[model samples]
Target: MEMVLEFLGNIPWWGWILAVIVLVFLYDILQKKHTILHNFPVVGHFRYLLESIGPELRQYIVANNREELPFNRIERSWIYASAKNENNYEGFGTDRDIYEPNYIFVKNAMMPFKVENKHPNQKDPYFLACAKIMGEGRRRRPYRPASVINVSAMSFGSLSARAVESLNKGCQLSHAYHNTGEGGLSPYHKKGGDVVFHFGTGYFGVRDDDGNFSMEKMKKLVAENPQVRAIEVKLSQGAKPGKGGVLPGSKITAEIAEIRHVPIGKDVLSPPSHSAFKGVDGLVEFVENIAEATGLPVGIKAAIGKLEDWQALVTIMAETGKGPDFISIDGGEGGTGAAPPSFADHVALPWIYGFSAVYQLFKKHNLTERVVFVGSGKLGFPAKAVMAFAMGVDCINVAREAMLSIGCIQAQICHTNHCPSGVATQSKWKQRGINIEDKSIRTSFYFKNFRKELLEMTHAAGYEHPAQFTMDDVDMATGDKNMINTLADVYHYHKVAVPFTGIKDIMNCPHLGGGYEPKKEKKDVKKAIKNEEVRY
Candidate 1:
């Protein structure tokens, strides 16, 4: 050791540097994994470095404030400001193209009224309101959701344990509900907040050893987790509508395997359809049975595709007087942990058209008042939430934005288990970057500020609460539809009246007899809406 020290001390520092560079070059030249490295040796390292940091450079330097895909800089900045409790107000006028096609605007009241402040007795002053869901017969118990903007499903296997813990604690602070994604329940989900346990076709947490649905396991979960406020049966997600949930084998750790009841180092694929139900009638029956067994509110999460299929479900509900307690509609633009490009890109309806179709259909069946509606998919911004409300969605669920609040950089590498921000990966070393305490606080702050902004927009639209916002409060501006029309008009919600006159007179009444049509129903049932640039 002394001899080595003496030799090093005798050698020049540049000599040592040169020696290390030579070693690195030799190693690169010998390695075959990377073609660039093998071809260009040390010089190729620069290319790899540049490629690794390319996303950052494009995000911060090259891309304009509004040019980023998915979520732009302006949107991300708003979330960051809310998370940090920093001022997000802009100094100059709007940079957006307000007159651009598909541009949306709120119909501000001529004399905007002041909305009432939060109740003093409320646990969290940031909590603006709550929505109560009550079911009849077996599902008689009522569950009141405290927040309109709650966390959407992002599974445990997909997100780091630290991220789940932070989100749960944040939900507790903000009085928001945290959804246990279809991956199933974990101890981390019970940190300190309300939960909505989601069940995909896989039947994860409540599945038997045979990977079949287990009533006993479900009862056990409900019995043990009092924090679970509701259950959502996921028929389909907006992203990868028909595809199943995929958890790569490399991500399945011992803990995840146990939680999900799947073999370690084995790829986990959830079935595309539930085994408990075969069709719409079976679906309704399944929901009723689950609600009766759990004695809690049960809902269905589905991406709209077939308009007649939705109509059939509503029609069945009208006939049987039984249906899900709530319906959560996911748009095609919604995010996911992992999905195939074909399913993610081509399947399902966008939130606007989907919500409108379902909403009007429910109104036609006189079942709108009985069921709650939740809108999800790219609704991270206050304006988007308000627009959803105006379109008749009772509440909104946010997935990616919540991830962003806890320091996600939109690396778009979530599926690789190499998330740079530590929000999605399961590796312990990578997960350490997310400080649960700090990120939890940031999450709470973001939720509070978002709700605050939503209320502000609600008041601007002459509504005390977002729930009061109607189709009249929203307008869509585009080149094709130049004039501002109420959402009701755009979605075609024509009114129909039935007179109490004699049967002979009723038969003679043209509107009631056959002319009564709310936005002329399409007669081409055989022809499906073609998947094109503008999908319904």
Candidate 2:
């Protein structure tokens, strides 16, 4: 023992350090989990360390305010400020280029509607509500949404339980509805908020042992969860239109398995199309059946692709007077679930194009008022919401914006289940980062602020409610600096008058402007005559 002690004492500190380095090198080379570590040994660890914090580096130091994709720094900052109830006002006049093509300009009225209550502590005088009552005169229980802006469809499986709970609580606080994504309704969703239970081809939560949609199970689900105000059948999402989803066996925890009604540790496949229904006709019938059975408003959500199917559905509805109560248009740009790059990039129509096409079809059939139009592609912003409302959308749903309110940093690594902010991952360790009470309050603040801004814009546009907005109220730049066109001219469809109760009040209000009148441009006669006409 004496000899051993003397030998250890004689060993230099440098020698010991070298020995530790050698051991680490051996571990790195031997590890099979990381190919980089296995191939490059000790040096490879630096790459991983850099990659782990790359998103933060880019967000803070590398990317500019307006450069980031999905959500720019400016957009994120606004959301964060609103969530914290801080000053969201920008110092500068505008960061956006006014001359840019497709730039939306909200035509302010000559005499804007006077806002009554502008006090900070007081509630907003302009209380925004859905213009149309969902399933009014058609269903057993008609629901009038208190707020026009609601939480979009985001499955509990895709998001952590804490995140879902926070969103539900936030929705309750703001009196906004929560759309439970195709993953099925979890206990987290029943937190006193009104719910729009959504199901995809999987028919989760409402499926039987055979993995088929069971009306009995659905009825029971609705009965037990009284918070479920509406039901939405998701034909396809914007992320991957016509494609299905797969929950890997690795992600299928016991809780998830039970909620999804799938066996534990097994891959679950969601087919591209519903087994319960076939074509457009069948889909209408299915929606009608669910509405009939549940005594609640039933809707359909889809990313627009070909117009043939939409045309047929509208036609059938017009002919039979039986169809979905609401139709949610998911723009191709919408992304909550991870999807294949090909589908996410080039598959479905964008929000503006798709919504206009669908709305026009419904208007053509004189069925615009029959169905509530809900748009869900980045319509969270005040300007975007106004544009959507002008194009005939009754409600707007926001998904990623809601996620941002709950501390999502837009790491864009949601698919890996390594969400740093704990908003998207299922890992308990990651989810522990979310503070339910704090985040819930933030969510409520964010939603209320959004509605406040939207209402402010609505009054500025000489209207009491968003439903009073028409295609003529907004205009888009036509790429040429010399010209601009109304949204009706741009989309090639005239706005059909929808029955709105707010229009009468707006017309009667003395403070409100009569109608949108474009300012006539003073033209140069000499230049015009030199360029073309002698007749003038």
Candidate 3:
């Protein structure tokens, strides 16, 4: 016993350190996966440690405010500040390069429309409702959206239950609708918000035992969830337009399996195309059947590619008057879901091109008034929202912006199921970080602030509502700083006027109509007089 104890005590601290280095060196050299580790051995371990945290380091220390991709630091800061109800205003001059190519410039009016009761403490002072009533033309159960901006499609399975619950509660508070992504309607989505139930090829919530879309199942699901105000059939998403997704068996929990109606411990495959319908004609018929059966507005969402199918669909709708109540055009840049690099980068047409082309087609067919137009793809910002409205979008959906409002740090590791912020991951321990009550309040604040800024910008442009903004109101700068053209000139299509009867129709508030009122606010008499002189 004395010999063994003496031998153990004889090993010094330096010897222990040396043994660890030897072990690490041998392990690194033996590993075949990493070339750096194989060549450099022990020293390569530091390289990996630094590389793993490279994104965080770049985000916090290296990259400037406007240099980051996707959502820049400046953009994220604004969202976070707005969510927290902090002062989001910047003191210095604009940091953006105003003369850059494709720079959007909103022409302000000489006589800005005076907003009355601007700081009302009521629940919803700025009633930014959509111009057209969904399903009104088809004699279905028509609904008027309470807000122009709403939460976009984000599935419960893709996000944590707490995150979904927070978003729904936030939507309820802000009077915005929540679009349930194709993952199906879990209990988290029923938290008092109006819902736009969305289904893709897999038809998770409305599938039969055989995994086919069942009309009876759809009807029952809709009936049970009265909050589901509309149905959206997703043709394709912006992330991967023609690709399908797989929910790996490892990610499928019992609750998820039940909600999605998929077998537990089995990889659920979502086919790229719908099994129930075949061509564009079949698609129209399918949409019509769903709308007719549910007596609710039904819509289609897609990222644009070849226009032949769109042309055919519009032609069918024009001829038959049986089609979707709304068409949501997702921009190629939009991506909340994980996708292959090639597909995400090269597949779909960007939002501006896709939206303009599709809108022009509908205009040509004289079907613009009959159908509502929704646009999504980084349109959550006030300026972007204004631009989208000018381009003839009736409503805008926000996905990642909503996530940011609820404490997402743009980790960009959403596909890994290890989202550090608990916003995107399904891990119970990770999700525990999301406090639903606190995050829900932040979500409501973010939505309200977004609408408030949008409305302010609308009034500044001499318009009562965003729907009244014409393409002539916005200008885009060409490569040369001196060269600029109106959006109408650039896009080669003028917006067809959609009737906006003011917020009174949606909110029953009498004071919500008109652009300017002289009698109510005599304080802006000089401004109003100057505005009158320049009035067209």
Candidate 4:
């Protein structure tokens, strides 16, 4: 004990200084920046003050085995392994948070194999969501796929060029179509696969050299890719449905600005509403013009506001005898490129409520035959997709899940653009740190397996085809643990077709293949051009 005290007492006062020096040194090396702590000394020495992803970082760099740590490491590695078709198992043991809530297991018993075949003969369902716009003079039309799933909008610009390429390849492999996010179509989009080019208000893919919308240019571009199956005008989205995107100037490279036709360093604002189409008539006109120009499927994506607003759209469709090919509905949970917190938190309608309401309106308009519906917002699990299909959506789109497959730990830093995962970053150094090819392979495998799980889920539900799903298939569980068929209590009339679209053209659209990007013909919306201004 005396010796221990002597050792402690003998410690020099300057020893503390040496320890601080060591910490600063380690921080510098870890940060790879000599100047990070030059002025601030001990405090400023450590640049980033957040919780270090210590175990995750080690798995990526040191362990090299990929899926090692719980949160970040092994999960991304598993995806990478699956994407590349590499060996998936690690001899170590099961890696997951087993204690998480509702961590149930499959009661796979010796049930007859015939149980899996129950839905094998079921047929695909169809939707008819047709509508017309107001100002543009043409009617909008959209078509839903026969089967249930389609690649949600994930543009090359919003994602990395490599990420887009891999996803397109996976889409082709999975026999699915990929939606181009609001980002314009770039070379990365054409992975020799089917793509739905989503046009935001920016006119990304169709912009001419001067960055203006060129109908001729759009026609040519659409013709070039036979995979360009559909066109979507993004009116709004689930996450920031009414909010325009804000591309930090750093991310807006010359090429991107040229494609989007917006100024560099300026916040790229796609105004919440389309000025060219004030009333329902104008909305229908634009849809018709694009359909005529493209000779392919076209639709819109948006969030539902007041009932009267959507009813107004139905009325316009009936009055003009024109409608969109389909409507892609965004829920309050839909993810966006970036948005202000307030708008994301408070603006949009939940998917189930919004989708059902719109589905009823389509039935009422009698336009449901030619148009289709695409659903988004939290489509990560097989059960989630199945429930949505039963509720009424024709197809499902997923965003954050795809990111997770490609190694996003939901760090909530996507808008910052300094993604450590190669999938989201453009920085060669940061991206280089992540093996793109490996991660892509993982992404493909994860999704493929997930689809199989969907099939399994449906089989368990006593359904075969994805289209056989209906509201009755989904049951609501009461607080008392009692279950009741949705048909007993859910409203069916809400989904019926509407004759009088009660409000202005409903601003909601779907985003399965992509989003709707309305064209603004009126140079300035403030000055009166022709008709009376629409009252808020």
Instruction: Write down the worst ten-residue block by lDDT for model 2.
Output: 513-522
10 residues in a row with least lDDT, candidate 1: 524-533
How do the residues 26-142 of candidate 1 rate in per-residue lDDT, one tens digit apiece? 999888799988899889989989998999899999999999978999999999999999997777898998877667888889877663454432444445544334353335344
* lDDT (tens digit, per residue) of candidate 4 on 369-447: 4566778887646666766666556567767666776666655666777777766665656656555566556655666
lDDT per residue as tens, model 3, 132-193: 87888573455667778889999987888999999999988877889999999999999988
Candidates 3 and 4, the one with greater lDDT? 3
Give per-residue lDDT, candidate 3, residue 518: 29
Candidate 2's error at 433, in angstroms?
2.6
Q: Would you estimate the TM-scores of all the predictions?
A: 0.84, 0.87, 0.93, 0.69
Q: How much is the lDDT of residue 471 in candidate 4?
A: 59
User: Which has the higher TM-score value, candidate number 1 or candidate number 4?
Assistant: 1
Candidate whose lDDT is highest: 3
Q: TM-score for model 2?
A: 0.87
Tell me the lDDT of model 3 at 498.
Answer: 85
lDDT of 2 by residue, 92-174 (tens): 68888777788898998999887555532244343466777688889866666767888999988789999999999998887
**Candidate 1, after superposition: displacement of residue 298 in Å?**
0.9
Candidate 1: which stretches are off by over 4 Å? 1-48, 115-126, 131-138, 481-483, 494-536
lDDT of 1: 0.79
